[model samples]
Target: MSTDRFKDLPIHSYQSIRGDIQTGDLLLCSGSYPVSKIIKKVSKSRFSHVSLIFQWVDRLMILESVESYGVRIVPLSHYFSDYRNSGKPYKGNLYLARHSAVKDLVPNKLNAMLRRGADLTGQPYDIEEIVKILASVVIDDLTSIRNDKYICSEFVQECYKKAGLSFQDDGRGFIYPEHISKDPSVKPLYELIP
Candidate 1:
């Protein structure tokens, strides 16, 4: 919770922070995109996006469902660079969160979660579901439209469920980045300022 650890580091330090990211860690982010702005407004939360981290070979990669690229695995470098180019004054304003119960997870369960995320690679981003989510926010309905595709937070929730850790179960698709961030089981690791 201390801002002291969230220093304004150069872009190159993103790689150093990548070393600290573990598989199944959640990368909660605040972005400058239009949809991001709307999500923040609706959720009333600073974070508008979330990605699950996984180790691939020698480096770390993030599995996320982005509107532009859909569900995909990208190197941590790409994730950081995208934020750096966002034109936001506070680029890379991200917080890393790890489930407090992760330490108690067996290796198989962790691997299952990673595999679940990996299985969704190349899936399309659910734009319709996003609209429904936004509409629900406006109406205060909180209903979700289940679909084959995924948005960011729902994908993360599914991965955690596969890993045997279930946090919020407002049915399957009714989740947002704020919901995950607010969960008491998820502990903040570090925040990258600017």
Candidate 2:
């Protein structure tokens, strides 16, 4: 694919960016995949994946549940580098957003959410849940599946719920990344362009 496909899009450098991204910021991505395409089409949104950010020691890390890796912590630099090395800008494009209501949360509450995510590291990705989510989209059902496994968005929703931030219900465990992006309480922070 050609970088020209994304030439007109705004680009921002991670190194040149100002200000600290506090813990609990949402990292949204327009992933390139058949599944991602379906998600974008069904949700009528550009985002396909969502991750939670947390400051781990001196570095910022993303907590996300992916089909291949399940729940894992990836350094922000590594995440950005993946896009830079890929050459295709749109494949790597990512947006950072924060829960508009999280500003009211005390430091303790924010830390609690981060801790909850950290504690879940290594859990297997819920492949079955992904199927259920896709099926729900096709059937126009918004019901969330009850399961011990987690998808990226479901994990994020659970973290917020643990921290006492309630997003509009989209079934018990069926929240999509688009759901998080569309929530009135989320505000875009920055875009990482190639």
Candidate 3:
């Protein structure tokens, strides 16, 4: 499909579809912060961040590797209400995405994926990797993504890899949200309002 299909998506109300979000779903964000703008400009991607959505028993939570906090879990509802302790909705467009391979994950693989994500919790965000990504290569090699620290895409990419779904980017380098968005096996599920 053309990239056009990924643009002009219809926004969906968060309240109406919160119940429909499944574990392994993705939250793709186009943030407006200064750093977010830098990422988008450098990567040439509309989305600057990506977070994995997991259903932990009775609640939905987001697993993301963010600057300052590293990899952490947050209540999914925080985005629609107060995000970043800023008392505002997220500062950019939010899109829900899913990998076609998620449904095929057997119990063992699913558990393994969750476990891997959990293990990475509290790790630091890869600030060095960000510098490396933006400094040397204009077309970033994303080479250091597999290190202990992670970027949001690295965490999500690593988790999905555990679930038996491997994105198209070779394991050689880090995966970016733009790369994931362009993958054939991933599809947009919704355009979340805030």
Candidate 4:
């Protein structure tokens, strides 16, 4: 893996990378909050929610492009903090997935379901954690958005809403928006995320 272009890509902590190590394993890196937040922003915009999901699907296509290589990529559940605390570089059985797989996979009918699984079930999901969850999710829709460039963000939002526990916003600095507020509509800052 030439990591030259991705040198800037955040290196997950040693613990985060270690637990998922497997020789020849493909690594899936992603975030939960940023994804949903972006979706929300797109939803609030004039563009249809479908257009937002389409954009996200396009991004997923870029992130998950490695699957095209025929390598099975997997998601990691540990936090980058765990990896960082471990104080070691990932070695032994981990590989980064192709960029396309990261961004494009979500658009496929088969993979879209997998992405939904990640968003909904990625408990304790953070940036690296979400990636790992997504990696583990099985792709069932490969052609849903093949011809179309837009996906309905409504579906994606529903997935995030279902996450219930486990999922957290992975935006640069933003935590859960609803969590910070007291309003019922506002998410609580901290909840029992399984």
Give the residue spans of candidate 2 off by over 4 A.
Answer: 1-11, 83-90, 140-142, 171-173
Better of 1 and 2 by lDDT: 1
Off by over 4 Å in 3: 1-3, 138-142, 170-172
Q: How accurate is candidate 4 locally (lDDT)?
A: 0.26
Q: Predict model 3's lDDT versus the native.
A: 0.82
Q: Please write out the lDDT profile of model 4 over residues 1-194, one tens digit for every residue.
A: 11233234444543443433322112322223345434334322211111111123212111121111211112232222232236433222222322122222233443444455344332321333223323323432211221111122222333333333122322322222221111122211111011
Q: Clashing residue pairs in candidate 1, if any?
A: none
Decoy 2 TM-score against native: 0.83
State the lDDT of candidate 3 residue by residue for 1-194, as single tens digits.
Answer: 33345687767898888888988888888899999998888767888999989898888899999997999999888888889888888888889988888877788988888889999999999998788778745654446645788988888888888877766653547567877887888888888995
**Backbone-clash count (model 4):** 53
For each candidate, the alpha-carbon lDDT, in order, equals 0.75, 0.74, 0.82, 0.26
TM-score per model over all chains: 0.83, 0.83, 0.91, 0.19
Top lDDT: which candidate number? 3
TM-score of 4: 0.19
- Clash counts per candidate, in order, are 0, 1, 1, 53
RMSD of 3: 2.1
lDDT of 1 at 80: 52
